[model samples]
Structure formats: C-alpha cells, structure tokens
Target: MENEVLQDVMLTATILIPILAALVEVLKKAVKLPKNLLPLISVVLGLILGVVSYKFTDLDLVLRLWAGAFAGLAGTGLFEALKTRIGTTK
Candidate 1:
C-alpha cells in the first residue's frame, strides 16, 4: 500500500514537472519577472494543477499537494540542470 501510494505520487509528479517547466518558460519569456521568482511561480502553479487534478487521481488533497510541490521543485531543478549542461545560464 505504501509503495503504491509512493508510485502514484511519483508518477503524477513526473507528469507534472515537465508541464510546470514549460509553463515557467512561457512566463519567463512573456514577463520580465526576476529569475528567483520563477520557482515560486512554478510552485504556485503546481499547487493549482494539483488541486485541479483531484478528479484524475485517488489521492487526497494532502498527497496531491505533496506531488505538486515535488513537481514544482524538480521542474525548476530540471530546467537549471539542462541550462547548465547547455551552457545557457545568463
């Protein structure tokens, strides 16, 4: 049961991370906000997505929120990692 829950959250977060990253990228391009705020925005967006996705998963609000938070943070890290790898840091 524990493993199943973990798998569910991980799967959900994995799906959400890339989407959050893309959304952040779009916001970055459209807005002139500071780079530091991107992560926070991603988190907020994640939380919103998480809550909105309640119908898609059996997980409760708390678990969904956790998945969202993980997705948000991992999404930011993924973008940074790729950026560093590509030498595109500004």
Candidate 2:
C-alpha cells in the first residue's frame, strides 16, 4: 500500500510539474512580473490551479491522480511559502 501511495505521489508530481512550469512561464510573460518572483507566483498559482482541479474531478484513476497531483502541488507551494518566509526573517 505504501508503494502504491508513493507511486501515485510520484506519478502525480511528475505530471503536474511540467504543467506548473509552463503555466508559470506564461504568467511571467503575461503579467510582466519580476523574473525573481516567478517561483513564488508559481507556487501560489500551482496551489490555486490544483484546488480548482480538485473541486472539479470525479473519475476513478483520473480522480485519484488529480487528487495526488494537487496534493503534491499544494504541498510544494506550501514548502516554498515557508521557505520564503524563513529566508526573509529578520
């Protein structure tokens, strides 16, 4: 079961990573935000995108995959948010 979970996690992560990266790039170009801010924005966008996906899926393996993907994406975003806050602490 652990292997299944991890496999799901990795599968989800792999798929979302590319989509997130591409979306981030498009947003960067579209909004003209600072290049340095891409990571932060990507993190936020990724979570929001994930949430939206989570709310709108109801298949079998596809649903599971989407759930896992969004979980990973949001977790990654949360990690980045924490990392940013930690790095900026005075």
CA lDDT scores, all candidates in order: 0.90, 0.57
Cα RMSDs, all models:
2.2, 7.4
Candidate 2 accuracy as TM-score: 0.53
Candidate 2 has its poorest 10 consecutive residues by lDDT at 54-63
TM per candidate comes to 0.88, 0.53
Model 1: per-residue Cα lDDT over 1-77, one tens digit each = 99999999999899899999999999899989998888899999998888888888999898899999999999999
lDDT digits (tens) for residues 1-90 of candidate 2:
768765654565555666776676566667878756666666566555555554344334554555445654554465445554545556
> How many clashes (backbone atoms < 3 Å, residues ≥3 apart in a chain or on different chains) does model 1 have?
0
Candidate 1: residue 8 Cα off by (Å): 0.6
Which pairs of residues have clashing backbones in candidate 2? Answer: none
Instruction: Point to the candidate with the largest TM-score.
Output: 1
Model 2 / residue 33 / CA error / Å: 0.7
